[model samples]
Target: MADITTPDLPHSRHWRFSLDIEAIGWLILDRAETSTNTLSQEVLSELEQLMDPIESLAASEQMRGLVMLSDKDNGFAAGADISEFDDIAEPEVLRAALERTHRLFARLEQLSVPTAAGIHGFCLGGGLELALACHYRIAVDDDATRIGFPEVKLGIFPGFGGTGRSIRQAGPVDAMQMMLSGRNLRATQAKRIGIVDKLVRHRDTLRWAGRKAVLEKRRAKAAGLTERAAAMGPVRGYTARKMREETEKKVRPEHYPAPFALIDLFEKYGDDPLAMIGHESDAFIPLMNSDTAANLRRIFFLTEDLKKQRQRGSSFKRVHVVGAGVMGGDIAAWCALRGMAVTLQDLNMERIKPALDRARKLFQKRLKKRHLVDTAMLRLEPDPSGRGVARADVIIEAVLEDLEIKRNVFADVEEQAKPDAILATNTSSIELERIAEGLKDPGRLIGLHFFNPVAQLPLVEVVRSEHNSDEAVARGASFALAIAKSPVVVRSKPGFLVNRVLMPYMLGAVERVEKGESKELLDAAAVAFGMPMGPIELMDMVGLDVGKSVAQELGHDVPEGSQFNELVSAGKLGRKSGEGFYRWEDGKAVKGEVPEHADLQGLGRELVVPLVDATEAAVADGVVESPEKADIGVVLGTGFAPFRGGPLKARADGKV
Candidate 1:
């Protein structure tokens, strides 16, 4: 594999052309301005210009075939630059931009010679659309290679020819599921779904292999008969209806218009690629201008900005988790998954095995890559004696939330670990300052709070105590990011940020239940307001006993004789006991009685107002530095409706 750059061919900062041995042109995409390539306007213009000469050559029978590859370390392209979307305020301008992009993609599709997209890393949204225009596509087979149209996440569907091309290539039903859910497919899955024509074993060899494959110009097999049957005519309508029903169960059509519009587009225009793409732009316009879109876009920027955040810390090469409970075990597992050496310390091997088992299951469920799982498992070392602290650069204590127990654990950890090793507590509710009180080198002690089901949730609250030095806090932040969790640096206080803001909401919700209001009604209200789960349902998942403990610790004013107290007294500790406000069966909540005619909108307000108030108070009290942190905390931590953009954004939009 070699790179050839010369003045004889056209070149741009984002794209360039090189001739392979077979005279096949490799249009390499490597945006000069950013680490990740995005289809910015400037990039689009350059691509358009490059195509002019390519088209002329194609007409003269000089070009053989084109293989598109990325010169970036990895990644074809993320998507179109979303920041540019904000500028297209008018429908006419948005339509014009969409048309221009479609024209460019169409030009690529009409290329006289065979075209193949060589994809690695992330080929998403516009990037996937670009790849679909190629006659064939070869993708690297790895966990890192993600291919999808995730524009729905930003409150818009793929405006480029993604919708039409995906339906035509893969079929309508599968296409709807991909676009509406915004779920990315791995290379193998992409191939199975008829999105990828060939799978490459290595990233470095993709260009050479793609050029060879395109030079052969083998006609890729069409979608299987079953797949085609599932996507067209009456069968397609049934599939679309089912998809819409499932979507409605989770998402309200009024709040989120993209998914419904996407469903409509595929259902109405699956056969006509031209009409399908035209409707895509029509459907995307209203959603892009909606307040929901703006708020979701803000979240997109926040998460993107978070990825670029770097901090100084001792190399977070090794981690020691002291305590083998759910939180501790999962944190240890997640660290190992990210390729960090982890030592999980518990009281005994009996306790340690469960944590390891939990981690092993999580790894198997996500990667399905045996070698990667084995590598992750190898990185995790179970120690019953807590001796691994000495070898760790970071020591996290995930013991019980009791102040005395935590203090004792911290003292033990501080004594056993190296002085420079960052000490962290995964205490969700306790004040970090109090936990670190009287400990030697308290500066090394910080809060590294991991949410439940650690492997799935992305937020990790990096709590900063008053004694925490910038370096210590930075190290904690760095470690959180290292584990693929978004870190929200917060001040030390009871309940910290996420739990602090959540206390009032939970207190109010349980209080309502105690007042004899229907459990179903309260939970329904939360779901109606866009919460991933109802407040009562969330409490049940967290364990009713745990919720009461947090409420007391945070001084939340739950009324006496509340359902929370009653449930604990009766030993109905939520999902564990299988009996709380709702009966549990097979890991699902079998809801009890629902009110016949309750003021649901008013109830939603009742559940939401307290969260908004608490978040505002937290921001004002300096517990959370800004509204952005508060937004991230609720969205990532508490499963706050991302479409609503956190409690504050909802309040600003008058939805709260």
Candidate 2:
């Protein structure tokens, strides 16, 4: 290999080209004016122009190999610029763009010298597709290094030659699974699955590893016998049928069509890479222009907008959760997982032990590594004597939903907590004003209401009353964001935002069940309308006792003779007690079949109308600041049909 240390070569706004000491041409991606690199039209066009210099280097025998990497520390690239998708209204226009990208990537793939992608952080969607185009992919071994084709999440599949190349590299089943599910693969997992050729210990060594892999002419992982067999016509059909069957179990074709379309693509063209590449846009173009795609993209932007509400330079580091029940324990554990020092205060260690146990399981599932799980466990301390109150930077009370109990907790917390420390309550339905009544400085108290099963739900209702200071409210919202939850600041009121909008919907379902509608049929109706679960199923998950309490607090009429109350009185509380409207087994509702002649569509409209009405009233009464905030809150907090955008959005679009 010749040693050519050139300072300059191809010039472009989004790419840097130079020859290193080892005669390797390093093409560094640094999208101008952005913290993260994305493959925008200008970026991709600049890359094509830069390819001229790359080919010249290879032709002159001055380059040993080509290594592509990013200058951005956050990621190699966050994928294609999604903002551009809004302008693409026609399939022909999108097809033309896809064809151009396919041509450019093909040029990179056919270059004389071996090419490698030095991947760090996230290489997702188009970024992953770009990596697949390279001869080799070398990733840094770290938690941040995530690689995947996440286009399916936006109601599309990989278009820039990913469908064919990924299957060629990782084999049909693994590649299809990665594309269909839109789940990211860690560096080690990527290496095992052949998406990555090698993994370096650190980002500093990524270039060296890429160079070594290129110079040594290391052969990429070849598909095994099983992989090859799976791609055969008969076998491919069987596998794709199985994939569709499994996918339909999670999402229906009417709601999410990308996964099914991708399965069909694989079944028809999995054997021939070239043919698959040529036909890729046939499936890709239509899905990109779909209503579901548009709504999902809207949701993606909404989520990003919410993240901007995070308070920078927050002084909160230590969290004290005063209760060891499900919500409190989970909240404390989540804080610990996010690198906060959390102290869980309860009456005794016995109560705290279950929380710790649950946290251990959550850690094992999320962190995956033993050392990381251990670190999280060490951050959570059990304080039976309430000693953490004096040292905590933020004190969150998650005790029982009794007004006096919460007031008493705050009275003690106000005295022991630091004067400037934030005082928050995780009250689901109670007004923050009532919770702050006994406090010496009520203005310092804010509501940080997290939904049940804190780990799964993303929304946190940051409730503020007339008594709360603006700084207190800002800090509460910041804390929610810091813990990786989307915070929607709502005025303190009974059933604030999500629960306020959700109560009537759940109660309406219960009322219909009492009037002779089948519980399973009603649930099916909700599912057909795109709700994640039926109201009955959700009530069961929330626990019937808890549901009845929130419903009453929200001023809904829950008649004493109602099935909901009757079931609660008989000790069948819900999933917690293993029985309600539906029997619970292993955390799943065992629902019976819906009747053949059930009016699912009519029932769906009837069930969803109350939710839409409540959302309108909540926005009108100023519970949330705007319709957009209410939409995000309902969608994330209660799983309110994301494809419809939200209740407010659905209403505006006349989709409800």
Query: In candidate 1, which residue pairs clash?
Result: none
Best by lDDT: 2
lDDT of 2 by residue, 35-60 (tens): 99999999999998878778878888
Model 1 has an lDDT value of: 0.84
Estimate the TM-score of every prediction.
Answer: 0.96, 0.97
lDDT, candidates in the order shown? 0.84, 0.88
lDDT of 1 by residue, 1-656 (tens): 46444235555778878765456777888898688898998899899989987887677766788888888876999999998989985889998888999999999999988888999999999999999988898999987999999998899988889988887778666777888899999999999888888898899778777868877885456565676676667886888788899999868987788898888877787666678987777788888899879889988887867765567434689899989988899899989888899999988999999888988888898768898788889999999988788989889999987889999998888887887888999999888888888787777789999998787889989999899888777788777887788988899988888888887887787777777777798888787777888888888988888888998888765556766777788999888799877789987899867766556766787688988898999999998778988887889888888888888888888887
The alpha-carbon lDDT assigned to residue 523 of candidate 1 equals 87
Q: List candidate 2 segments past 4 Å from native.
A: 1-10
Residue pairs clashing, model 2:
none
